[model samples]
Target chain A: MKLTLRVWRQKNADAPGAMAAYEVDGVSPDMSFLEMLDTLNEDLIVQGEDPVAFDHDCREGICGACSLVINGDAHGPERTTACQLHMRSFRDGDTIDVEPWRAAAFPVVRDLVVDRTALDRIIQSGGYVTAPTGSAPDAHAVAVPKPDADHAFVHAECIGCGACVAACPNGSASLFTAAKVNHLNVLPQGAPERESRVLDMVAQMDAEGFGGCTLAGECATACPKGIPLQAITTMNKEWLRAARTSKR
Target chain B: MSWTSCGWPPYGRRMALATRDRRPPTVRTLWDSSVGKKTVMAVTGLIMLGYLVAHMAGNLKIFFGADEFNGYAHWLRHLGAPVLHSHWALWIVRVGLVVSVVLHGVCAFQLSRRDIKARPVRYAHTKARTSYATRTMRWGGVILALFVVWHLLDLTTLTVNENAQAGHPYENVVATFSTWYGNVVYIVAMLALGLHIRHGFWSAAQTLGVGSAARARLLKGAANLLAAGLTIGFISVPVAVMTGVVN
Candidate 1:
């Protein structure tokens, strides 16, 4: 397959950027999206030009490291991570536009590489359980209801990919924060710090200059894991509940 | 692994408690949070939505006839009589609505500004991502706000109504709707109002955390129904006057 690419190129975070077009030939249909980029990069390196820089890890789509807004959709047209999206999804002669995630909270580091430490900051605020660390506990020691376990498992599917923020017109991180907050808030082990977890993480998100959610449902659509939008509603409920009842 | 063996997770519960110790949790009140501001927007939007329903119902009373409509108008002024002063109940309702409108508009404006600022760079390929009603919310809101001003001036103050009279609201309404520009502005504003409510109601439900997977469909349907009903109810008055059904 031969295709034209309108890839965004920037020298650094402080430098300006523009759409630099390139043509690639001899692309295999079985190659993943990143491998196609690898073909482009190999040609650029041979030509003594700076190749595009992006993030990718675990090429399996679970690490949440790969980030790209291809043709205006996060991770291209596929509902999976960029690394997991194959070249066959695109037709030959297609002109694909690739750019990094757009959000004040996630500033671009270089071409198609934006800093997502803001998400780490949010998790740091509160996204964990204070469980005792020792020998393995009995499986039946903690009895989690079936429904609650399902809720936790579903929310835990979030890969922290930042696709939600990239696709959101408002650049809101409500879904990501919601996923982290609800993943643990419903579990018996997570009960001790549940209230503080939501309150602090939400506050941290606000501090990161991310926009507020307007329920446009874009984030959930861009999500690779198919995390439901109702995750945000649950987070909002938890926040309100915490604000009302939390003592310290 | 080291973080675990060091006795506790460095970025977990201890961080939350340490921050709370340094500053009282109340120091960052609900108003300071994005979620909290949305609560304010949701509550105020609901208030305005309620008023629109009441206002549309009252507008329908014009179909009954001039005397009955005028009597209904008079009755509103003297509402809560023997205990409350004349126009007092009316004044109270008006003031509450004004507050609701102010808060709703302010929150919308602030949230929109932040939304724009959050994404300074635009995508190279511009694709329409959301629904028309969702995209036009900010502009539709502005149009509705300007229409509210014109509406109050034309009907309440008798400033823009043609050949105005103070006592007869039924006649004043007819005179206002009789003109072409009046019909044009009223109809356009009602359409904008419809679009606004179509998204606003459902959005408010999500912000307040009342909507869920089971009820999202219900809330969306209800929003559409309410938007259509209010727009038709209010626009019917002008249509009736123009068609000679109410004169």
Candidate 2:
């Protein structure tokens, strides 16, 4: 297959970025999207030109490291990560436009590589339980209701790929934050710091300059992990409860 | 080791508590974020929706005749009688509605501005993942705002109603709807209102955390019913006047 690629290229954080077009031939349908990019990079390197910079660690979808907005949809048309999206999703002679995640909080580090440290900061603010290291507790020691446990496990699947932030019109991280909040807050061990967890994480999310959730729900749709939109509502309820009931 | 065993609190918890001390009161903090603004919009929107339901029921009194319609309007002022002065209850409701409207409008405006600021660069090829009503919320809100002013001027203040008399609400309603422009304005606004309510109610339920997987379908159904009911109810008054069923 032959394809035309419009990929955003930036030298560094301070450099201005623009869509640079490249044409590559002999692309295999079996190749992954990143593999296709690797082909282009190899061709560029052979010509003594600069290679395109993109972030990818584990080629598997679970790493959440591969972030790309393919044809304006985050991760691609499929509800899966960009790394998992095969070239067959596109037809031969197709023109693909790839861009980095665009959010005020997520600055471009290089071509198609935006700094997602904003998400890390939100996690650092209080996306954890205070359980100490020791002998592992009996699995049955904490009997979480089946429904709650199922809900928490579903939320715990969020990979933090920043696709939700990318797909959101408002660029809100509510879905991401909600996933972390609900994941920990629903469990028995997570209850001790529940009130403070929501408050601190929410405050940090706001400080990061991400837009508010309008319940637009695009984030959930774009999420590669299939994180439910209800995660956000759960977090909102948690925040309301904390704001009302917290002593401080 | 546990955080306490180290003779210190966890770093994140310590920072959170420290920040809480420097932060403003809970109410102010809640008002400062996008989530906070959304909560205000959802709560106030529900309040206005409540009024719409009641107002629609009152407007239906017109179907019974002038005496009943006029009586219903009169009863509004005399509500809470014997315990409170005449019009006191009405005034309280009016004030509450006004406050809710103001908060709803201000929050929506600020949140939109913030949304725009969040995305400075436009996407090369954008795909919409939301519904049409959700996209039209901002413009729908503007139309509703304009309609409210016109509605009050024509009905509440009697400033735009050509045949408006000081104390005859039923007659005033009939007179206004009898004109072509009145029906046009009312119908257009009602359409916008229908779209607004359909999206607003569902959005409010999500914001208020009133829907779960089990109840999601029911909440959405209720939102649709409310939107359709209120739109038809409000539009029926003008349609009846236009057809000379009520004069």
Candidate 3:
């Protein structure tokens, strides 16, 4: 399959970028989206042109590293992440417009590559259990209610791709953050630092200059992992309690 | 101070003026119109909800004693640390709250209108992606607004109407709930408030960009607990008043 690719090009963060058109011929439909990009880069290298730069690490979609906004949709209209998206979805001679995730916090590094360190900062703020993960305790000692366990598992599946942020009109990451908060706090072991975790993570998320959530529902709609927006609501309730209790 | 386009020459100002024609095309507005209003609605709605929680807490002081409840309200009217709370301060807060309410209503109306206009063709199978709180935000706001007005009339106006107790402001609350309709409305409104608060609490965090997985989960849990508490607190007032628990 031959296709026209209008790819975003920029030398660096400070440089102006625009969509530069490239025509690639003799492409296979079975090639994954990233694989097609690899082929295009190989062709560019042979012609002494700088190949497009994009972030990808485990191309299997679990790493949340492959970030691309195909056309106007994040992760290309699929419920899955970019790495899991295959080229067969596109038709012959299709004009594919590719761009980086647009958000103030996730600035474009070069071409399709973006600096997602802000996500890491949000995680570092409170995404972990403060309780010492010591030697293994008796496995059957703590029995979690079935519903609680299911809810925690649902929240634990977030990949932190920033798709929720990108898809959100306000560029809010509450859905992503809430999932993390709920996942750990529901378990009995995570109780000690639950309040502090909520406070620290929320504070860090704000400090990173992410926009507020307007509840437009687009973020959850675009989320590859389908993380619910309810998680953010849960976080808010905790913050209020923490704020109030601390004042006392 | 001067026009520069990346070393490219600016189009001739005279040429631009010539191209400036009468009857300028009406610029189509996107989010700055629709989604922007929704944002304002979401934000102000959250503020109003915060006020509801605080207001309920204040009202629930009646459970302590009439003197305590009255003192709480009186203190609110006169309780500013550096500057004493006065009639003017009370009115100012009231006005501010009213303004927030109005802004919330206007933005909601505009956003809903846009939503209706944008999608004239309804989908065959479309489930609203909204949560319970978001789905009922408008209804909750309306209920709260009505409650505010009625509550003021119940306390401030002291109308010697048949429905109200003649000389007792507290008794009016009791008498209103003694009837089934009054209890029903109050309970229903509180439920609406619960729904609103459930969504609003966490939404406020998201709007402020403080949402994270752990924090969000905690916030949602807290919001549910708070909503339940507020509902019970508000409902307890009517229940207590009707049962003659409070003289």
Instruction: Arrange candidates, best TM-score first.
Output: 1, 2, 3
TM-score of chain A of each: 0.98, 0.98, 0.94
Evaluated with lDDT, which candidate comes out highest? 1
* Clash pairs for candidate 1: none
* Candidate achieving higher lDDT, 1 or 3: 1
Candidate 3, A182: how far from true, in Å? 1.4
Give the per-residue lDDT digits (tens) of candidate 3, residues A143-182: 9999899989988899888888766655666677788888
Q: Write the per-residue lDDT of candidate 1 for residues B92-193, one digit (tens) a residue.
A: 999999999898888788888888999899999879979988998999999999999999999999998877899989989999988999999999999999
Off by over 4 Å in 3: B1-247
By summed lDDT, the worst window of 10 consecutive residues in model 1 chain B runs over: B13-22
TM-score of 3: 0.56
The candidate scoring highest on TM-score is 1
Cα-based TM-score, every candidate: 0.96, 0.94, 0.56
Better of 1 and 2 by DockQ: 1
Preferred candidate (TM-score higher): 1 or 2: 1
Model 1 residue A208 lDDT?
87
Candidate 3 lDDT over B103-138, as tens digits, reads 877766654543343223222213455576876776
Question: What's the true lDDT of residue A19 in model 3?
Answer: 83
Task: Tell the DockQ for candidate 2.
Answer: 0.53
